[model samples]
Target: MEKARRAMFFLLLLIADFSVAQDTAGEADEFHVGVILDLGSLVGKVARTSVLLAAQDFYTVHRNYSTKLVLHVVDSAGSDVQAASAAIELLESYKVQAIIGPQKSSEAVFISNIGNVTQVPIISFTATSPSLTYNSMPYFVRATLDDSTQVKSIAALVQACGWREVVAVYEDTDYGRGILPYLTDALQEIDVRVPYRSAIPSSATNETIMQELGVLIAMQTRVFIVHMSSIMASLIFTKAKEVGMMNKGFAWITTNGVANIIDSLNPSVIEAMEGVLGVRCHVPRSQELDNLSIRWNRMYQQDNPYESPFNKLSIVGLWGYDTIWAIAHAAEKVGISSARDKQPWPTKSSTCLESMVISTNGPELLSVIVQNKFRGLSGEFDLTDRQQLKVSVFQIINVVERGWREIGFWTVNGLLRKLKRDYSKKTGQASMLDLNPVIWPGESTEIPMGWEIPRVGKKLRVGVCSSEFTEFIKTYKDPITNATTASGLSIDIFEEAVKRLHRPLSYEYLEFDTADAPISGSYNDFVYQVYLQKYEIAVADITIRSNRSLYVDFTAPYTESGVGMIVPVKENVNTDMWLFLKPLSTEMWFGSIVCFLYTGVVVWLLEHLIGNEHVHVPFSLKQLAITIFSIFEES
Candidate 1:
């Protein structure tokens, strides 16, 4: 009986093994997804980890699904050519249906072109240059918000703070240049002028950054908008602090690139970036997100045991996490494996000349992905018509002593109070009062005037034109005191205008004249001096003409609009017969004589007809006219 039971058990095990083999063969369909990233970069590392974790989590939830997602990640090594090469290899060799990444905007440009030719979707979470739009490359989808969308928010901040002039300090790469036109347009809409643009190269040294900082410090504009990666921004602020440019009068603002990475920075880096304001994507807190955060930290720590814990996840990582799910859901929605196999995958030799390998299911998968909408780690997962994230809310944070603090929220409508539950349900205005009080540079609570005249070291070199007419502008030297003084109408007007400024200004009056008496240059030459930067500004009786205005800017004229003519009035000395008729024309004199005769006849006729006792029948017509005239004079 025992031998018979053992034989039955072996038979049952053999039958179960055969059934499991058949089941595994039936579910052999694997969807190959490729990832192109610079794994050496901070953002790239986070992205790679996020995507790996997402795939793990996705399979765990949908273990019974028909197809499984197999990720084939390739390191681009932070080079554009390497990124493109990696993408081509994945498409031709691995037959990947979708690609995520090539973190930089420049890298994405080349890789996205390859994706278009291959009919594959190139989804990028951090390549935010506005130039990478879906209009040109239909297969390119921006999983993250475009950098252009945030320019309006930055402009609103500048407008709300009453900054009349702003200077943009950004990297010289495509990531920096792409958003400049949009930023300028937005600022122009709010009547703010971008006086200067300081473009620093990505590989610029400390000395170069300091040189740029020095140039900005000497400028009159104190409000600066810094748009660059976190590393470069840290260097800039460090140099700014060293030069005393990050003091009370200075204002610094950054974009999402630097802002989103603040939590992961070292304390020393954070210290260098103290009092900097930044705009970051607002990710609403949720239970699922919290759970994911915990799981991600554990997995990340286990994977990278030597590195420190990040403690916080950026939107870039969150977008990566959600992108994998989006692709998975889209792939599962179209359950036909024949759809992916219908189009022939090209070989290395076949695509050597053209590099074209069309994916049969690319369009359908993209359609489903575009249509897919759900609450994701980075808020709502919806793509706009432009194939970019449909996010509107952005948080304005201030870098303080203990990491960053949320000061306010900015949306398409305007700025709002600190974001909370159901915050999107309410609308708000772009007013400073709506936001929490910000501790600006120098740890001051007061709002900066946004401009300052260097108090300690530098003085404005004001150019004053020496005039032949001393009444307009007179410069004299005291014989004994050896002191220079300037006085006159022009000087008074300049002083009064300076007094009316929002803040105090220190200026030294520099008379632009030879050792001789009066200035020799024309008004046009005098104004050109300002353009050449020989002097900060010129104060004189400078006539504003169209030609002069083309070379340099001019303030509203302090004097009258046009020239005034002054002439003496002569006494009237006419001794002719027609002199009496000078006041009344000759026609008027003739008409008055005829009117008297007609009035006399009419008065005599009326007196006879009415039979007035005062005017007897024997009364002459002239006498009746005189009586009528006397009555007219009295009444």
Candidate 2:
């Protein structure tokens, strides 16, 4: 009977242990994470696929992890209000520990504020505005580079290509406008000028884009640095091509925002962007990346059946995939737990925002995420600085037929260098020769001049003047037609300058000469004519004077001017033996000696006659001569 009692107790203990084991096995931690994106856009679609795939792949590899990230995605639908609403819903309803995306920089602004209030970490792989700083939003982490990081590379490219001036064509949103200041400052550092900033609204119509392009084409500046979204960029380039602005003289450079997604742009857009140079983040090719691309292409096609089959993964997608891994690693390391059961923080019922509860695991999770370091598909995924990705290298690509070609690389240290070569940190201006041969716009091999001669308005009125010095300028009249004509050095130089413009310049030289046939009015009056808007330009033996500069601008003086005197070179030299005597005539010499003798006599007489004993002298010719010589010396 005692043995039966012992067996029954042992069975009861075994049952208790089994119950505990089953409860533990069934209770896997679900760490809720929110994802907000513009599902209607191409970038949004690609990022979504990459994020989902990354989560699946990471879990498949690390099945033993106690914490599982449960993603709750919400479509922002490309609206900032919608994105904000989505963030609030995720925080209030789902009680997410973290949030990813809210794609655009403008959209990230308000949503990031929400993250700060809730103490929930918000990580973004796409929003790259420099204004979204870590200091302002402590809970927000940028998994990709700030747009400002690549501005230096763009400036380097402009400098290397010898473009002195560029027009910044950008969308008038935070994402587009944020980089302008940095780009302008960088270009200024290199002595390059930002002549104009063309800010196109993101919602601008095709006609509006074309009108802006027309204004750009009419201006003298030919180089355009486009900083805008891929959609706007596509329309802009297409309109530019239609307007004949993609000719040989024009240069177009796109920032990484558009460049990174070049593969996903349609063939028509790619064709329109031919000969365009672009700066993009360089992701080193690897076997893992290749496999990701293959899988991504297949899965993307399956998910987006109606979309074009040619769509491929972009750099943003890589960043999104890497971001998932980063978050997952941080989650497992910090061991995040469900925060729903925690007590709600004090509130005043001042809207749903006030009633939200703060996550208990957010601060620790954020710390781990910012400190996480690992090799990701995009590059070194180190966010230890808690600001943005460290962008050391950027690829310089040239758009060609069907695809783009890698021409060179721009490194934070090396500036610019050709592919397949190791380069040291360099100082001074980078040269275009470091890159491979570039096929410029209109399929021309020649580098663009970055400017054009003004073609609008009436032909330039060039006033020519005649001078007495025919070598400088000569004006005359044809006896048969009585038409005025100009010739000589000034005419030749002016014509040559016009010829070198590479474009046709319609100009007629109006001869300004006096009726007496010597020359025109004073140069001051001729220059004043230009200032009065009578003549567009005046070419003659005109001197550049400070007084004239007040009214009219002057080209650099082609001919040096100043007062000069030329004396004949003397050949005969005076080698007379008595050259010293040539300074005075014989009569003059005798006169001087006589005067000295008279003066000596007067002095001697005064001494002797006055009975002064201080004067001592012998009554001899030698004494007399000495006295005269003394007088001469004194004189």
Candidate 3:
């Protein structure tokens, strides 16, 4: 009797468990998914909470529809191997419709493989490693940025701070290693010179760091860029402080860098880390986050309830959260139905969901991707190309006193214009270039690095105007005799400059003849005589005006004297009248026009001629200019 009673209870228990399992399995025809993640790390945990909360909100608001969402969670403990195992199990065994959250690069790489095999869509929250989509995983997508998007920004910040020589210390893994090539390409494209880089192993020691630091110090490295863990950053900062370098002032630029380690920091640590500048691609201040912070603080008493204690770790983490929300919102746009009571929810496999992807790769899909603009929680997001983020936004932030202050925002065109080539093409002013080409801010590579040693040669004879107020260097007789050698400040500068360019230099005293020689004719003779490889180049303190740029290329000018008056500085002189009135000065301006038209014809005629100096100097046709200038004025 007792055995029969026990059997009856066991049978009822089995029946109840079977009914519950049946409901969950049969409900799957409505979209279901698996979220694979670490759930332990601060970034992972925050991402997990946001997605779950969002999905809950998405489903509850759409209950009028028959659609249902069931999400299964899988913990990988931040291991790629485990993440892959879990992802495969979801695709093959449980057969989820799609997946989200392979929060780091290593796992994302392997999980991408499962998406390929099963043809289920997968999107990642924070895997920025390059070559992401090429894992034979056409079905995969990333909800985060590519590795190189803000590398130029990071390099710019470093260059802006005038940290010319840097030492790179990166983690050995894919996340850390991925930064290597892309950041290097960015640095190189900007022509920045990096002296040393160290690829550190995961098991790096204080001794290894010390050895590398010693090598860097030997090379005179003053800045350190730590591109690894917070653990690594804290350790290096502590070591730097111990080495007395931090206190004595060494620049610390962290890549994905940090200002202070909040949870791990003490009063002394904050003081030690004060001067460190971390390079981050800052997000524009979002009204959504501002509002969220207000509500979250009132309820949870935290800056970011969904974020870690390092709440403002970077705008990157917030952007990641926004990426997931953006995908959901875009899904709503395309999957939405007009009938409120009979709408269909977006399945993870829905064709409507596929149409709105802004990052779908392939030559054909580029136009479609560009057409969609997503409104994310943080801000709007779009893609201009496969690897490029089209958002024209960023800021340089200086973190201080438990908050951040804006250093400035980087507008796309504004920054480019700042770095646009220094030539006068864009500035519309030749006068500016003639005066100053490279602005040496009391500091610059005044002499380029590794300046080439000059070749020894016979002294190069160069000529300049000898008029007292001009660039002409005078010659002096030896005490009693009437022979001469070169002597003047301009002469010295030209001589030294030629040697700087590895050319020989000699000087010829050009005493201007009493007669006014036709300038177009005389210049032809000067080029044939002075510039015929006899002297490699000339620096005559001559006003290039305009005609010279056509006949000969001028090295950046050495000196420019504004039109001067022999009258005393104290005297009242109508120099304005003298400027256009002096026949010699007017010729200097007008002959420039004559030479332009005449030189081209002369150059073309002389090109293939075989005679010694076959090109005849063209006489200045004053009739041509007298006609045009008068016509231009009248018109």
Candidate 4:
């Protein structure tokens, strides 16, 4: 009886195994997709996890779908050449219908070319250089906002803070340099000037970065706009803090590239970045997003245990998550297959890249991806122009403590106190005050002036005139100290003007007199001293002559110096025919005579029309004259 029972159990197990195999064979078709990323980098690690999670969650929600995306990830290891190589390998070996990333813009350039040739869709969620556009590469699609799209918001912030000029500090790479032209043009539209551009190579040493920063410190501009990756930005801020550039009277603004991933920075890096203002792509919060963030943290921690525990998910990760959903949806619509039909190459070549087959369903898939619209984890995801997703809003953030705080939000219209509010015409345009109060560098609440008097370790040279007329400019010397003191109207006026400046002005007076020379130079030579750069400015009782105006600018005369004419007045009136005309000017006399004639003509016409007695006069001239005399006498 025991042997028979054991045989029946073995038979049941065999039957179950056969049924499981049959069900797996009849499951949904697997659609192969490739993902290329820098697995060693922070963004790479976060994005890879998000992409995996998105794929798993998508299939679980839509199990009835006909197709499933099977992702094949490759580690480009942060190299452009490697990215391109990985793309070729995926296209030839795996025959992937779509490729997700080549993290950096510099890497995307080469990989995108590969996709164009293969007729496969290349979707990048983090490569956001404005130089790469849809019009040029139709097979490439950007799931992220272009770096140029945030320039207007930067310009608006500059304008609101009343900064006249700014210096742009960027990495000397394609991704860093791509947004400069657009940034310069946007600032110019608001009447702001970009005085200088400071480019630092990605491979530059700490000493090299310090040398470059030292040059910026000697300039007059105190405002700086930084555009670079998070790693490079961390080094910049650390150096800036060391050099005292992150103190009071200095302003810094960061582009979205750095701001989006600020949450993932190390605690030490965050401390160095305190009191910095940033603009990031706004990701609307939802229940689904909240749940994803929880799962993402768990999965990321499990994968990367050595990374900082404080590191949190950022918008870049969210973009990576949404990007997969978009591709998966498009793949299903196009009825993609792992074994897609490939067109024969015209001629076989030596290189694998040249000999790769073109995907027949690539163009159809590209069209579907661009036209796909849905509310994603990172807000509304729509790639309308096939180049980039439309970005209408950006969140303004301020780095503080171990994290950052939301100050306000920027929209297409302008800055807003709240993201969603009643926008009347009068209240549409918000000023800097609309944003929450900020604690600037040095932990001060005062807004920076954005400009400073150049600190060149020397006082300004102000040349004063030593004239015979002590009332205008007088010089007194102290016998004990051998110090020369300037007094009088011009000296007092010039000193008062200096006091009214936004910042303190330090200057030393040098008398332009014969104390050092045999003979005193004329006023022309004194003003010419300024033109020769011997003196930064000249203060004296200077005349506003046209010749003197050519060399140096002169302030408007505070005290009058020109000659005034005085003539005798004749009060006695001579009795003559012109004496009556003296009361009214020549034009007024003519005007009064014309008015009297017009009044007389109108009265005469009225009497004739009404058949009054004034019309019975046979002589027309006599009647007109009588009417004129009567009207004038009545007036």
- Candidate 1: worst-modelled 10 consecutive residues by lDDT: 421-430
TM-scores, one per candidate: 0.78, 0.81, 0.52, 0.83
Per-candidate alpha-carbon RMSD to the true structure: 7.0, 8.7, 21.4, 6.6
Candidate lDDT scores, in order, read 0.81, 0.85, 0.53, 0.85
Q: Show where candidate 3 strays beyond 4 Å.
A: 1-30, 60-68, 205-211, 257-272, 294-317, 326-372, 383-388, 401-404, 414-635
lDDT tens digits, residues 265-381, model 1? 767777877788999888887898899888888887776677657535788899999889988888788655745564544565644524445777888877888888877778778
User: What is the Cα-based TM-score of model 2?
Assistant: 0.81
**Candidate 2, 136: how far from true, in Å?**
2.1
Taking the tens digit of each residue's C-alpha lDDT, what string does model 3 give over 1-635?
99999999999999988998877554422444678877665455545555655565555655443445456778898688999888767755454556776877788778776565445567665677776764466656665566566676667655554445566777777877788788877777656666778777767799987775555544445566667755566666666666555533255556543432232244455455545555455454577667654443343224245543433223444554554444444343333222112222234785523322222222222233333456656455553332226345444444344333444433443232232245222111222222222212112313122211222233334544333444355544456753345556667786676677532334444332213666554554444444355544543444565655555666675666566768646667567855665656767778877876566545444442644233334434653454345445544
Collision count for each candidate, in order: 0, 0, 3, 0
Candidate 1 Cα misplacement greater than 4 A, ranges:
1-28, 339-357, 384-386, 419-430, 454-459, 463-474, 478-483, 487-502, 512-635
Candidate 2: stretches off by over 4 Å:
1-27, 336-338, 341-349, 413-420, 424-430, 454-489, 501-536, 556-562, 566-572, 575-635
Model 2 per-residue lDDT tens digits across residues 1-635: 99999999999999999999987885658878899999988899999999998998899888778888899989999899999999999988888889999799988888989888778899999999999987888888888899989988898888877889999999999999999889989999989998899999989999899889878987878999999988899999999999898888999999999999999998999999999999998988899899999999989988889998878988899989989998888888877544554556666666767767777778888999988888888888888877555677899999998699998888865555564676776644445776778898999998898888556535668887877788988887788986668888988998899888766777766766555532334677778889888888898888778898999888887786776999998789789899999889999999988986689888777667877554455477866666666576767
Model 1 has how many clashing residue pairs? Answer: 0
lDDT of 1 at 348: 55
Tell me how candidate 2 scores on lDDT: 0.85
Winner on TM-score between 1 and 3 is: 1
